[model samples]
Target: MSAENGTPETPAGSTPPTGPRPEPIRFFGTSWVGHDHGYTARRIALAAGSLAAAAVACLVLCLAYQGLQIADIGSFVTLLVVVMFAVCSALAFRHTWAGFSSRPDPDRQASLRGLLTIGFIGSLLAYAFRCLIEAPGEKLHRTEYEAARARHEKRTTRRSGNPKKRRRP
Candidate 1:
């Protein structure tokens, strides 16, 4: 009476078992939706849209960086901007993911609105902080240049076009 064969098995014969779950799938508020093959298409489209948005943002940032290179403090500013951008974006993504995981059916539009709102606020705050932090450097430079120009002007006198001295030598 082997356990595999139920030779107890033949006392009462049986066979080995193998099969998937008997339970039905529930997708998008409807059962049996997972059985259909069309969901993959929807998933692909979603992925493509996300990739396109990311590509556009990256391209814009790279091109715009070249124009900003004239600033002496551009490297520090650029580093701050990039770090802030990444952090804010990560936070927005986290908020949306949490919202989605908690809800039976999340309000996607609300998530989008929230994401945009949060991003704009973060950008504004970062810009304000950067400006405030950089003010001292700008102020010092402006005053230094002004003072140097004033000193130079006072120390040296400009020559008149006409010479008044007699030419006898």
Candidate 2:
């Protein structure tokens, strides 16, 4: 068959061949129960982005609560806070990237649990949502596996020929 329209030569009444295996979705090199890597990366990126936004919001609220102008904070203190935020943001970004392209690293994953704690919290929520997303895909995989197995059994049975036909002879 031509590469563009490649199809398996399944005989009539046989199950159609399935396409390629599904990709796993992951964050920090850990897969979501049923998502592919690409989907997992996007989800992690979103979580990281929201964490940054939360940091900014908290900073604003802290300043408002203290009734202190930005100028009232010492330059050194402001610099330290900004630097810390930057480090955490960098960690979140790196964790998201690692989910997509690298093998699982337990050390790095553990560090992220501390540095990107909000990511952990958000991931817990996302895990529940992923079940909804993955349900259909899981069903499809099961159906395809069953169909392939049935096709294999049918082929083997025919190749061996009917036992009754041999017994009659």
Give me the runs in candidate 1 sitting further than 4 Å from their true place: 1-32, 35-37, 71-73, 103-169
Clashing pairs in 1: 6-9, 7-10, 8-11, 8-12
Candidate 2 — worst ten consecutive residues by lDDT sum? 24-33
lDDT of 2 by residue, 30-78 (tens): 1333344444555556555655666665676467535434457776776
Best by TM-score: 1
Q: Give the clashing pairs for model 2.
A: 24-36, 24-37, 25-35, 25-36
Model 2: residues with Cα > 4 Å off, grouped in runs: 1-73, 118-169
